[model samples]
Target: MTLSTEGIEPISNAVPKVWHIETVLIMETCPMVLAGIRHLLAQPYFQIKHWLEVSMVVDIPHIIKRHEADLVIMELSGEGESILDGLKIINQYLANWPSASLIVCTALTDDRLLKQLVAMGFMAFISSRIRYRP
Candidate 1:
């Protein structure tokens, strides 16, 4: 008995061009971070058709659906109970949308919160610095 593998074609090693079609929905409460991310992802590789700095929950579902976001970048500011509260909000939202990659940028990178955030399932956790552009 002989097995035939007639329909196999080798892929090109010439770096098969990747056309980025996935849209990213940036949700930041801070204006500066929103602007920063917008500027950073303005390269040819990415297409950001829609971006929003959400100050309220009412607008989140609409933006997420409208943008067809592959990635949801969130920036959280402040500390103490405030930060935890924000984390709760983020965690809830992320729980709802497991498909969306959540990258969190926060002003406070303390060990405890970092661990907690990691456990909560953040794709990337970046320190909040004005010079820090991810």
Candidate 2:
């Protein structure tokens, strides 16, 4: 005996598909670092939708919101007062966009500073200075 075919719909056709492209914003004062980051992210494997670069840390909040960045890569390095200011800005950015992920790349290896940054909602910390292992 053979069964007769009835009306049926595939799940893919029933539900609307949505795609989200990841966007990145890089805030770094150093030109070489910025170039390196751009080059790395520009590769097809990263699949970055948008890449925004800014030298001033103060513009982070504005650019992040404007571009709807999925990730923010920032370089945090400065003296006492400048570091404090950068921390404040970072805090403000996090407070405004709790969903956004922030990564810090800095030459400063101070334990206390890293702790404070983690507390301020930094997703990851990367050391700019590479130690030679010979």
Candidate 3:
């Protein structure tokens, strides 16, 4: 059966009081990551409001605010682009949206890098090698 938006019920007494949909912005440069997310959250319960591939993290805040996104799934590859740059972007975002949840969908294999990302305000991290949805 096809999932219909009309059949989806809103969670009762949700905090925001706006009956606003919780949207996820898939921000990954990798095609596989994008495809995986598209598959993972394709269930009726989750909504993929938008998918964007940004060249810089500086552009993230505007997109988040404009979309009023509930979560962000980003690709964190410590190669090519320095992790420091990514953290800087997160720091800037925290200045405006401390409560926004950002889940890093990275290929990093080191536990230290994972911990660092968590400290940098990523709500959660899922290895790119994993395909299961939370």
Global Cα RMSD, each model: 7.9, 8.7, 8.5
Worst 10 residues of 2 by lDDT: 76-85
The digit string of per-residue lDDT tens for model 2 on 94-128 reads 88888778888887889999889987878888777
How do these models rank on TM-score, best leading?
Answer: 2, 3, 1
Name the best candidate (by TM-score): 2
Q: What lDDT would each prediction earn against the true structure?
A: 0.65, 0.76, 0.67
| lDDT per residue as tens, model 1, 1-134 | 98785775546434444435366655566677766777777766565565455654344566776655677676653312356556766777688877667888766658898888888887998665566468
lDDT string for model 3 (26-49, tens) is 667677777877777775655455
Q: Which stretches of candidate 3 lie over 4 Å from their true place?
A: 1-20, 48-56, 77-80, 130-134
Model 2 CA lDDT for position 74? 87
Q: For candidate 3, which ten residues in a row score worst on lDDT?
A: 12-21
Instruction: List TM-score per model, in order.
Output: 0.64, 0.72, 0.66
lDDT for model 3 comes to 0.67
